[model samples]
Target: MKTNKIIVGLFYLPMFGLLSCNPQEETTPQYKTIQQAIFASGHMEQEDEYIISATADGTIREFSIREGDYISKGQLLVRIDSDVSNTQLQEARVVYNDAKQNSSANAPQLEQIKSQIDQSKTQLNLDKINYQRYADLRKKNSVSQLEYEKAELQYKASQSSLQVLEKSYKQAQDALQLNADRSLQQVKTQQAILNDYSIQADKDGIVLEVLKKKGELVRKGEVIAKIGSGKNILKLFIAEDDIAKLSIGQEAIVQMNNYPDTTFTASITKILPAFDEAAQSFTVEAAFVNPPQLLLSGTQLQANIKQQGTKKVLVIPSAAVIRGKYVELKNGEEKEIKIGQKSGNWVEVKQGLTEKDIILLPKGKSKEEGVAKPGGE
Candidate 1:
């Protein structure tokens, strides 16, 4: 038994030494299959907001609303101090009245002038008879030729005076007629000017902002206030590349910054015809069908629009897929992948990896010289 033990010890001692010298090999950096959440982050915005501006130039006499005030359609937003204008209007009215009273302005005033002419004619007839009697006396030599000439001249002077009076009366009547016509036009012009005293809202909405202070001067046709159509909509901006995937009536999930947990239901409402030149994105308008109770104008929001067409897809963290199809594999292998339908967070994986294989997701690129590998971290 002692000899057998000795032989067993000798056999095991070398094996132990060999095993002690050889440590377990460190695990090599390897690519891993990790589920990564693809994310597209943006904020929420209110779709329906109206901005108001000033219309007519004058000091604001009264302002009916402030920021965040609810107002109705045709509500008087602001009033300008139109005291001077009103006074002018009143003066215009007086002038108009005076013009109306001017009898010469009316054709009937011509009758008054005609009556004066008839009276003058009667005086001329009497003077002519007197002149004729004087002329007969001069023929009997009781009156001299010089006296006859003087009487004839006096009668002719009366006739000329009547004609001149009639002409003057006709001119006065014509002037009165012109004055009446002018008065009527003046009244309308004054009314139109007076109407500018008050500024009214064009639509039903809350006041988002008050641009002008009370008593601020403004010009005609200048925009004073803005109103948003009460559509209760949300404006969402989808990237130009992703806009093609969005269509009208497409479902979307809306979230506001103020309310984090709640998700308001919404759908694509309109796609803008023109793209913003500065922002390389399409303007997509969405309607919140069942809007949240806390919703208000100018509320910021975040949107996630899901693209249609569901095919089996391999999705990785968007950070894992960089510069098109290239992604880091679980084996620390950076390889190109075939990509398909892409939406907000998930994209369809057409090629390069299978369901059986796991893809590595990189948190992000490091500023270090070494390439980002699956097991390098």
Candidate 2:
């Protein structure tokens, strides 16, 4: 019976206790408990960091500011040597203006042409009536053959001339229409080129980087500079483990090495549903409800996102939790528990334990066995 009790004690010890002076092929286990809470690792970030790119290909003529220079709305941030583009644009504008003026002038003339055409048709109609009367006289033999032949020739000639004139009028009409279409197109092209040459800032911001140097060639839509307002905001990249616990409007505390004592008050304004593909983090935007005066742009920061869930929780260090599924309880007492949000070195223990429990760390373990070794925490 004493041997049986000792054998049972060996099994209940922290990690698997090697059978102490016991039979071969026998070992004991131990366990422990630990405090649990949700944890995460996140970096502090700025609210706005907008990228500025060029709209068209050109040489960098000039930049209004250097990197880190603060700017405001309506700032002349960058300029391109659009001299070539400008000249081209100017030429285009001249052509467009001339074409539009010509089109407008020709448009009014169309009515005059139509009236002239109507007058010509009326003259042709009068000639036809005269010819018909002459023919009737010839058929009645009232007129001599020579005179009748002359009259018949006159009528035929008039008909042929009218057809020719009509063709010419139609041709003029088509040419004017074509000119109007072409002119309108030229105007739009000039407008686009002119817009490309002038680069004005779209927002009130600071120039973070001058991507292109003066006289350097830049492609349209290529990044010409990086810009952002010195707006007081934090862009925290929360760890995937802790991302689920965060919700919009939850209060957060942001910290930076520059201002350790000063905790910047913030609230979650946005949370990305998807994780960043490269960083494996979820983006969370925080608004500074009570901002410190010292908060500046691009300052590295850390954030403490508060949890609103008030339900009690159990948690332990990952080291204390043996294996993937279980943890060592007090003095080698082993228990199986479900885990929760894992911030960093610590993981939340949701099941099989309570808060403030002192848990033992499973320091070492054999690779082959499911059990872990207790180095005695």
Candidate 3:
């Protein structure tokens, strides 16, 4: 009987050794209400950012405005040295004045033509009177036909001379008027070119950067400064694979790198349809619900956009999930699971597991004994 009892105890001793060797933490899944979300990182950008560029090639003579300066619409930001343009403008003004004077009715050339017209009118009236008198005399046969014929010839010659003079006056006037108009247009063109030397702000904004300093030469279309509308907006880049899951009006929680302790709420305001090759992602824009008191441009941030629906699902410790696909049971069996939603340290188990099923956490993973209660962080 003693030998039979010793063999039984030896058989049970190995079973005890196996139980003691298992050191994994054990926990069970619990029902938790959670919302699905996608994560993305980006930075804050000022709305309506514009690059101020030089319209013409010249050296920047005056650049009083610096970065962070507030500017209003049409405010002069920089003045370029335009000596050549100024000289051309002066010459244009002189030519315009000369043409304007010549086109005027009181010009010397017009005055001379007016005097000739007056003299021609006087001669025409005298010739007409003499011709009419001679015709009356010829009707009464008091004058010879040769005398009346000479008077009529003189009157026709005077009329022809006056007509020629009047035509000459009109032609001269028109030519001068045309010249004046052409000169005036040239003056306006020069004036516009001179205006290009002065760069002005197109809208109210803050100067974000001053790319060109005083005395720096800038070519046409070269960037001189950068301005922003001062209104803050989130410019997020989402992964191409995750972009399709996002939509306008989705809620996003933002944590700025500068304000690490605080989190802000925002809503998706815009989403670009095309993928950005440079960023390797799709662009998304958001508006803050209640923005911070002071916001700076280009502030780095991270955000999580919550999906539309929320439901109660069975969830286990994220540490217990193996390779994001499987979890180990307390009985030393590996169980594969289909996950649905994920929050900080918790993962939702959609299938292959129940609330009654207990899981073993892997080595170095945080292990909570028993079942974890559903609660918000």
Candidate 4:
């Protein structure tokens, strides 16, 4: 009986130790400010960074600006070798000038046509005088009817020849004028093509990069340099599942890897509608309200876009809420609870649970295990 009592005491001692080590975690909901946000990772970029490309294929004769140089709009940035284009332009000008000279009112061909017209007019007047004489002579019986008829036929032939000369002159003038107009258009087109060889800045910006050095060959449409507007902005890529929570004008908190201890505030300026297949995410852009004193382009950053602002609401540790729609009560029973916005490690209770009710953490679960959901389920 003594040994049996001792064995019974040991068993009870182990049981008591087990009961003492495990305890139910419970907490009452309290009202506090909660912020709901969506997280994204991205990098810093200039507000307007454009890649400048060559408009014409040529060797880089000279580069006026270097990297990190500030330039104004319409400033000449590069000079491409324009020997070929210049030669072509000169040839076009010669052709245009020749065409103009040929089409001029004083051209040799027009002068010859005018001379022929004057001669034809003089001959027609002489024939008309002879025809009038023959008519008078025939009426007076001084000349035969056949002689009068011959004079009349000669006069008509002179008139027809004069008309043909006048028409030919007009046709020659029109043909020369048409040729001159076509040559003028060709000259203008060549001039435009020549102008493209000298690259100029399209906007006021700083030269961020120069892809080709002097004397390097650049093809038409090839990127030659990069320019920045000198204003820093954040570019983010949010996952497809979380893109719905973002909107223009929403505020965001930005943190850079370089500035680990500091966080900057910004506002959503743009949300791109297209998805990037390479990134498997949607693009977003933000502008800083008060930017940091030292910021560089291409700096990587992480951002939290504020979807819901801070508000005083009943909240509990996220671990207390289970399966998103239910919560464990202090009385060891699971009850359905309506949830609202969530941020960080806390969740806002919208219905089914009140501040007066006590919430129990799941068995063997700690507060740290409750991860905040981006968008509350």
Candidate 5:
């Protein structure tokens, strides 16, 4: 009985030993196409959208269009209260007209000067004739020397008076011309200011928002409306860590949360040089090559930007690569590896790995657990 018990115990001991030992789980490197991509979250926005602001301060008297309205360049969009501007312009026009009349050849001031000069010329002519007669009488001794001298003095005084009047007239004409020119310039300036009261569209676009309504007081430089150029595009805010992986002209796959089944394709068009402090990310812009039919501005979306094109390379599951620089063998031996491009699920083995190499999964995980299944099954 003792010998039979010992044999049974020995058999059970071997069974326990076999049960305690764990089998080695291994995976081989694969020669497959690997793509390097970066994940980003962003929204859709019009590439040419901009804000329209008031040029002059006034209350909005009328709005020619509303939100979602298509408008053209130079179309009047709003009319501010122009009572003050109109009054100013009218006053300026009156002043300008007065100055213009004064500057004209038939002006009352010029006419008065001409009439005075004509009268002075007539008096001078009479004085000259009298002086000539007085000189003849003095030579013949028919009139006194005092009479001839008085006639000469009268003629000389008349000549001086006429010259003075002509000079004064010319001076008056010059002054009137200067005043007219100044008033005309003021009128032109006033007219320009009045035009500011009528706000017109600077470019052809769709009105997305009307910030100031009728009768609302708008200050100069205040935003009154938001306009969009009617072209829809995607705007993304990529994390600073992932910015280095992106470049212009790379392909991007876009997916919107609202439309789960649909996917859109785009290509990177612009990368802003400055970082957006508010979003804590870098701004990037893309245009759709094959866009969704009903994409609207301000729609939220997620995108995966492919950084590198697909290439046939030695690849392994990300879990099989330890600390990104080495891989563990099935025999518990670690080997240093040089890796290159990496995606979320896999990493490219640039050197120190090949398809023939057998790598171990992390401890306690089975081959099926750590290995990326074939065809992502």
Candidate 6:
């Protein structure tokens, strides 16, 4: 009986030890201020970054600018082989010169027309003199009636011929002028097309990348290079769910992958109005308040944008809330609670609990697991 009693005591001792070592922790709700923020991830980009594309189809004859080169507006960056365009331009030039000469005051066609007019005028004067002589002879009965009528008809015919020649000269002049104007327009159009073969920088910037080789074939509208303003800006991609919380002038806490030990501050400057379908997120642009000494383009980063102002409210460890709806009480009962904003492991308790209420931590969790203390972040 003594040995049995000793065994029973050991068993009870083990049970007592197990009961004393409770796994769940207990804490009372405390009043504190919590700030809300939206999480975003993206990369560093040069401000005003844009792709330079080919305007005419041809093999690249010359690519003058290389990566990391500084360029000015109107600087020629590339020249296409343009053998065909050069030929077309030559043809256009030939037509333009011909048209210009033809439209000049001393054009051969006009000169020939003027010479004909001079000859006609001379013949008209001779015919008028003959007709007058015939009329005077007829009045003196020195010429037959047939002879006078013949001279008068010859004078009238000369007058009609002169009028017709003048009209013909005017029509020919107008047609030549019109043809010259049309040809000149065609020349200008061809010249513009030829200019497209020479690609020039549209803005002052740096060449970030060269996409085409010197001998590569380039199609119209194909990208040839990437360019941007040398200044850097942070481009963040925010999820659709959190995009609505973002606004201009908000503060951002940034951590760049290149600078692991440093944290930077930035202010939101722009929010793209449309959603990015490829990325499945919305883009937000921010500028650093005090940028780093050196910045590399396309640097990956993560950030948190402040969504709203701080608020004073009842708070508790997030682990205490069961499935975001209720919490375990100290007396082994579940009490429903309304939660507002959450920051890390801390949550704001809006209703169904008071500062005096004691809450039990969930299973397999403890205060040491990054749970904020009262009045702490």
Off by over 4 Å in 1: 1-51, 103-112, 117-175, 215-224, 278-280, 309-377
Q: Is candidate 1 or candidate 4 better by TM-score?
A: 4
- TM-score, cand. 5 vs. native: 0.62
**Model 1 alpha-carbon miss at residue 190, Å:** 2.9
**lDDT score for residue 221 of model 6:** 99
**In model 4, which residue pairs have backbone atoms overlapping below 3 Å?**
none
Which segments of model 2 are wrong by more than 4 Å?
1-48, 66-75, 93-126, 135-141, 144-160, 213-217, 229-231, 307-377
lDDT per prediction? 0.63, 0.62, 0.84, 0.82, 0.79, 0.82
User: In each prediction, how many residue pairs overlap at the backbone (N, C-alpha, C within less than 3 A)?
Assistant: 34, 26, 0, 0, 0, 0
**TM-scores for every candidate against the unseen true structure:** 0.54, 0.58, 0.70, 0.68, 0.62, 0.67
Which whole-number lDDT from 0 to 100 does residue 206 have in model 6?
Answer: 89
lDDT of 5 by residue, 123-226 (tens): 99999999999999999999998999999999999999999999989999999999999998999899999988888887898888878898899899999998
Lowest lDDT block of 10, candidate 1: 368-377
Residue 232 of model 1 has an lDDT of 64
> How would you order the candidates by TM-score, starting with the best?
3, 4, 6, 5, 2, 1
Ten contiguous residues minimizing lDDT sum, candidate 6: 368-377
Candidate 5 clashes between residue pairs 3 or more apart in a chain or in different chains: none
Residue 162 local lDDT, model 4: 98
For candidate 6, the clash count comes to 0
Best by TM-score: 3
Lowest lDDT block of 10, candidate 3: 368-377
Candidate 1 residue lDDT tens string, 293-317 = 6656666655556554333445543
Reference-based lDDT, residue 244, model 5: 79
Q: Quote the positional error of residue 217 for candidate 5 in Å.
A: 3.2
- How does candidate 6 fare on TM-score? 0.67
